[model samples]
Target chain A: MSAADLSRCSLNSATVKHASLTELVDAAAAAGLGAVGLWRHQVQEAGAEQAARAVAGAGLRVSSLCRGGFLTAADEAGIAAALEDNRRAIVEAATVGTRELIFVVGGLPAVSAPGQGPRPDAGPGDRDLVAARARVADRIADLVPFAAEHGVRIVLEALHPMFAADRAVISTLGQALDLAEPFPAETVGVVVDTYHVWWDPQLREQIARAGREGRLASYQICDWILPLAAEPLNSRGHVGDGYVDFAAISAWVSGAGYTGDVETEIFNEEIWADEPVATARTVGERYARYVRPYL
Target chain B: MSAADLSRCSLNSATVKHASLTELVDAAAAAGLGAVGLWRHQVQEAGAEQAARAVAGAGLRVSSLCRGGFLTAADEAGIAAALEDNRRAIVEAATVGTRELIFVVGGLPAVSAPGQGPRPDAGPGDRDLVAARARVADRIADLVPFAAEHGVRIVLEALHPMFAADRAVISTLGQALDLAEPFPAETVGVVVDTYHVWWDPQLREQIARAGREGRLASYQICDWILPLAAEPLNSRGHVGDGYVDFAAISAWVSGAGYTGDVETEIFNEEIWADEPVATARTVGERYARYVRPYL
Candidate 1:
């Protein structure tokens, strides 16, 4: 596949984080990329309108405006604030012609909302498992209508089980689907990131299930670092740098009926220090090389 | 819940790793522990017969062996050797009169079997999730007869997802139970470690499910370190030092009809630096204070 066939591959600004918001858009456009995912901080740094204009002027699409999923342990007041902030983000995404708001659900109450007082800690057994699930679903239910009014689809990203404690209460695709079952698939769906879900046993089937239900809101790719026991965090590898078979995963998602953009979301510290253009060019080429077969 | 209730608490030798096999057994007995879990290396160093004599002399029961799970993956022949070695473990466990053999199902064939050539890497999509699960069941099936002949139960330890790559493919209680579903719940069950399962949203339900089905083999306790994102690996805290709710977990297990031993299993580098007696004493006190409430 040429760069044009790979136009659907979006750059999640995180992949070239060294670049400022303006430079990131310029780099994406210069590279002939069609879509880009923005971080809220980046959007704020450049002024949302200015950033959106930069992408629009470059003829690049705003695939998704990341983040708005920390509803796990926020207080009523905090929740209200977060909802309002998310609404603003949605308006910004809309200004840039982005339709999806990606959610990286917060972990623990403290981590999710740093200033919040610690919630009561439960023992593994004391975890009112039923209540926790209900809490998550209820919070999402409350936020769904607000998100819908903004015409911005909310995509819950399923993190690894390791993050289950303080991060997202929803850890698996199945769990996310269960949460989304009550709402329309289009309004509330999941963003499938390879790095998080690759280790799951039910990946293929879950992707197919999501595809069948049209619940796959976003498709992001990142490789899993080997020797997982080595570096627990800040150890993400670029595509084909580690053990995951991109071709197989891409094939599965494609087969599952997901025709959405394949967003490259890399969270490695190593790549963050590189020159923006070099990072984007290299990663884009590699994804085109290693990940293109499946796409 | 004083020392009297400590009757159901077992000291996995690894918890007091500072001690030799004989010393660990001596320490447990000194603390009035009801049971003890031994490692193959510790047993080998002290001589299996002598180790068995020590436990008997201490009037302490052997809860389960530390491990015999890594089906060596260097080669087919090596894999066969591992099975044979597991048989030896069965004999050893029987000699010591322990009923359950804890299995830490090994990871990547090569890393799992250190001396083996490079093992094939996992795929992009839940790398070999299907194969790993099947292999675990098949390997256990192959060893079941030997275990049955010796009246030894096989407890597949459900590890955290981080270790899913090379430590144990059976990462969750649900996965472990699925592997145990075809086998007798008595013969095949799970070793639920607090550190591993505490983060799982489905933990309580799974524990209850395991108990209802008679699949709860052994219960282990430890604490999870805070600010986990800072240092993902090598940051496990002691029982009350971190965020896990041990008392609540203990209550859930006991409530689930699981009357088995609650083994203290800490894997902290800091504690390991101390002498075995001190570590064992600390574990004993914490087990009594924090865990007793749940019991």
Candidate 2:
């Protein structure tokens, strides 16, 4: 398939996670995918300006920045540090020419995050999920002006409920939209990642609500595989390889008036081991067959 | 602790899975638990009448039957078989002297159910989750009369969303309440298992709503432990061992007017390997410390 076959598809960096900044851009371009979702780590490694030039140089669009939220800090110092880092993330998003800056948003208070180790100093593990959710809303509010100034929207991504403890307190699209409703849609928006939200009972209603609110910033797709991995986070599959109903979800998004580029964001270990260009091409084929028709 | 110390506590059989029905009844009796939640398997193995007699002989009340709903089957045979099995489960619940019968509704279409192997003839994996959910509603409607006739309330248990693909399609209290609302509260009700729903943002309101509708049938507790086990089904912990805020959840349940036996139903491998009596007493101590005060 050529670029013409996958016009509306974007390859999320995590799909071919082994690929470096230069490698990913090249793979996306060679695979005939027109866009790439850049993670903050890769962007930082290449420096934002260089990364932007390289992406543009390859004739590809930057769909959105990977993440910048872990705002569930319990202590004052931790909270301040999280906000400061998010501010920097906004600047990087602006530099890279993508208005959307996805936020994985941290876990419940005092829990050990994946990349960040234990926060024993933060006091006993806080199971105040409501408080943590409120903290996310407040942090988004704090970053809204900065995000707006940088022309980057603080895109709220609700990780699946399974990750509510160690990855993100935001566990539903409805909750993310609630947090975004308080701000201008342009300044604060929510993502509709099928893998994280496909099982939600209120998904259709919430997707419609997100569209009506003018806060549907991005669309991410991946399949929910069976027999979860040893690490649940690595259990995602390619678009058609597992159990997600992409056609149904794509219709909902399209019905909601979201015409943005769809990003394929699989996190499977085996998929990552594939050649980056091959993975991108495979994502494009699956997206075309499973999602494009419905969209 | 004595029976007086945990007046409202019940030990679910799964908490001491290694014990036979006789041993479990005796262990729960010795541990001072005044009630027990019976799983259909053990009850089936011993004959429901004998199981009830044994529990009653130990001076233990049968709080509720473990489960009975896999109504999401796609094929006619699968659907009929599931309904027939659930009907038997209702009879078993009645024989065991419990008004409540919990349902862990089946997962997506065409997938191999945990105990049952693959369904190659069931056709390709059906991703019509909305359709699968609708099937559940229709099946529940079909079973309501039978459940009510036997003085059994068909209790909907919303398993954690992570289990949505393989275990239960019902994933939230609100969703469960919606399904239960079409029938009489005495005939159809919803369960609030804290392990399954503690992370829900709308949990407090939903619990209050479940109570308001007079459809809150059962209250089960266990902690949502960190580092989910390889088999996530066994990921639960004792009340005080994880990040769940039992005080907060218990207060909600109390405020919701659920004055019933609070069953401790942990499925941890380690806890199962412990001495049945020791595990029962440990569950009692944790429940008394973390959950009872607020209730």
Best by the DockQ measure: 2
User: Per-residue CA lDDT of candidate 1, range A193-260, in tens?
Assistant: 88887767677888889888888888888877654433345566788776465777888888987777
Interface RMSD of each: 5.7, 3.6
State which candidate has the highest lDDT.
2
- Candidate 1 CA-lDDT value: 0.75
lDDT of 2 by residue, B42-142 (tens): 99999999999999998999999988998998889998999999999999999999999999998886577652323446433477788888999999999
Candidate 2 Cα misplacement greater than 4 A, ranges: A115-125, B115-125
Measured by TM-score, the strongest candidate is 2
Q: Residue B154, candidate 1: how far off, in angstroms?
A: 1.6
Docking class of 2: medium
The per-model DockQ list reads 0.34, 0.51
DockQ, candidate no. 1: 0.34
